[model samples]
Target: MKSYLAPKFIIERDTERCINCKVCVNQCSFDSHYYDADDDKVKSRIGKCVGCHRCVLFCPTQALTVRENPLDYRANYNWSPEVIEDITKQAESGGVVLTGMGNDKSQRIYWDHLLLNASQVTNPSIDPLREPMELTTYLGRKPDKIDIDKQDPQSIKLKTELAPQVKLDVPVMFSAMSYGAVSINVHKSLARAAVEMGTLWNTGEGGLHPDLYKYGNNTIVQVASGRFGVQPSYLNIARVVEIKIGQGAKPGIGGHLPGEKVTAEVSSTRMIPHGTDALSPAPQHDIYSIEDLSQLIHALKEATNYTKPISVKIAAVHNSAAIASGMVRAGADIIVLDGFRGATGAAPKIIRENVGIPIELALASVDTRLRQEGIRNQASLVISGGIRNSGDVIKAIALGADAVNIGTAALVALGCRVCQQCHTGKCAWGICTSDLFLSKRLNPDIGARRAANLLRGWSHEIKDMLGGMGINAIESLRGNRLHLRGIDLTDTELEVLGVRMAGN
Candidate 1:
């Protein structure tokens, strides 16, 4: 009952503007809105409000408004209200605090500190409208050298031996979001969009649904520690197989899908018992060292008959550079580096905000290390975490990433309000929920078109940016650090980004 002592959000209803339609009453999932028979008016129970703005968006009368509570609790910098509330909640329930989405704390977003440079008087800028710009990217190991025979001087024959490669029409791919964490509609939408965009979408530790197996040509199947829903048929269908070592949201930790969300469809897809907790151990017990990782990499390759490329994903930690080098040496065709800003279905509030390094620094350092070792061509690099628009994607490529993964941005396109209440399995938007009624809020056909439009529009913007840099092709922007400059940063910070100050 003490939980009602303080309401975080205040829901206000204007009696004059209200039409008594009770739309808010029917729309609110939190049960915050109601009708008082004696008063013959609509009212709000502030204690139950979560400030999602769902009622405000759906209300036609324009009578409802929600705001943060202004109540004070003896403000203290060291013992702030948030701190006190956290303590109280912990004291009340002996459970770890959970949060969804990415870290919300104030941290240095390096992208904001850096700026892109355009052509000057000496160098002329090319117009994308008049040029044939290339956006095609190949994700796989490339041969050190191609051989040609000089035996026949008139007709020289060349030997072509290539490892597995996944061709993309654009340099963006959807990041991991498991079947249990998101609804089947989301998976269907992403699958359709990926096929339309000529890119790929990932199945993050969740087993593939039989209905979605048809999208195998444009899907990347993930094998996480729990091995949920992973079978030989799943491996044989995907164009690429990813071994998930960890993610940025909760590095050094496994994933947890609460039992409440394990519905029949989710249960069938994951091949797990219904109404039971789904847990992925912190580390794959079978993998302990680089050699162990290599064993698994080769084992996956063997399973797919060397027809598909294998990718290894790791969070950007302090030792990410060395770790990436080890992964490349372990025969991984691709390396996915997830930064601190990466999103998740659910994670502990503490770890989500404090445990990983930024992708900018990690990408720059890993690229430099790999180049210095003369093995940069051994594996392709993909980075994710807080990639918002086409500009962010262009900047990431300039910083040494071959591609950027879009997660939160895609969810936003599907109408997510970023309420950060996904862990409760009661998402205001249907993108993150398992409830049949809530899940129906998203139509796969419409969501697919929206996702496709976002990618298509972003691809055009990327080409325009490349053209502004006096380049006609996107490949010229890849790892070309000279095209970027830091605005205001220490020398060390600039060095880590491998970019000079603007005007230098």
Candidate 2:
């Protein structure tokens, strides 16, 4: 069947520099490059290229160049090139269009519109280089009041009982990315980095691998609808246990790890059969209401003997504020909101681009609602999805996020190009694939160092930003939206974000 699709990228090899080394042929996982015995030359079939740039990176002589195919079509804003190509692709495949990573649409990124305030003269900014700046954060419920008994100035006693909390040296955590969805080396890297950075890393419903049990202190075991590998040990081994209700990338749909990506190791870790697709139902069959959710939350706490906090993760949606209120009232110690721009291993193109609300607005609303109801101290708030840098992390904290999670940013440090080819299980960078040959490309030792270095750099930047605001501790910045001002934003956007306009 002669398909009507054109090559997405054009591969141009410099024949004069090409040495016919077959390096491109071996490096390309998409089968775009091939060795032609008839002509004794290295050639490329551009149609199969996914634009991963693996071959281009490995070409010793630097003879290969790949660029967007720039195929012209009738100009119609309503029927844009991408739209027409999507329709054509579906017509030929008769299957849902699948993609990896977050939404690439030109949606309003609130971070760019929001500006941070710095102290001028009255506040007197502190120098982070010479002064002490605290970035330590705790994730868990907090007591409304603490009772104290002062027998003497030096011998005060009688304190309030504190809820179990996970202490983080910094407020940034590595977001959940499952085993089957990515290679085990990536998991090892995350786990090791979390330990070194004194933060936590989530295991995204794929369950924990046996080797990762040693990093339990820095691990967050996830329980999705599938309950792939839920056991008493699994519940007890982690610092925190999170219940995954929804993700920002595909809110209403379930998670799908295709059978081809599921190997023996993944099957063992997730407790599913080898070569079987791991699908988590959209909704937890056991949870119909907030009451049901409370039961499960209590069940997990009971399983862990109340030694750790239980977190509830949900996608940022229209009714997030109301839903978050219920979750706190339902015995949740921590609430995680994954915003619309969150990344994923696989999701339908339609849903990834359309559904869910932005994390900025969602964070502001939820924080405002919680404060209004005086339940803000009952549970900690953590935001995720599209957190790109330390500036975004500090902005999130000012908007009421106790901490932020980074998935795509962490992957980028590990060499992901955001090529969106992860779902095909052919990730040339080896960060997102499970194939033995490709998975080894990511060395856990090097990966761990790179991921940890990212945290270190961001932590330094966060302290600098905080010091510029004349704040020495991160806790003081929490829910302090006064330090944030909006530019090029609507009145409604400013109101929803709980921020004043710039120059106000």
Return the top candidate by lDDT: 2
Q: What is the TM-score of each candidate against the true structure?
A: 0.96, 0.98
lDDT of 1: 0.90
lDDT, residue 348, candidate 2 = 96
For residues 1-504, could you state the per-residue lDDT of candidate 2 as single tens digits? 678888899999999999999999888888999999999999999689888888898999999999999998888889988898889999998989999999999999999998899999888998999999999999999999998978687989768888998899999999999998999999999999999999999998998899999999999999999898789999999999999999999997898899999999999988889999998999999998999999999999899999999999999999999999999999999999999999999999999999999999999999999999999999999999999999999999999999999999999999898999989999999988989899998999999999999999998998899999999999999999999999999999999999999999
Query: Which segments of candidate 2 are over 4 A away from where they belong?
Result: 152-154
* Ten contiguous residues with the weakest lDDT in model 2: 149-158
Model 1 misplaced regions, further than 4 Å: 35-41, 73-75, 149-158
Residue pairs clashing, model 1: none
**Candidate 2 lDDT for residue 125:** 94
Tell me the tens digit of each residue's lDDT in model 1 across 221-265: 999999998889999999999999999999999988999889998
lDDT of 2: 0.94
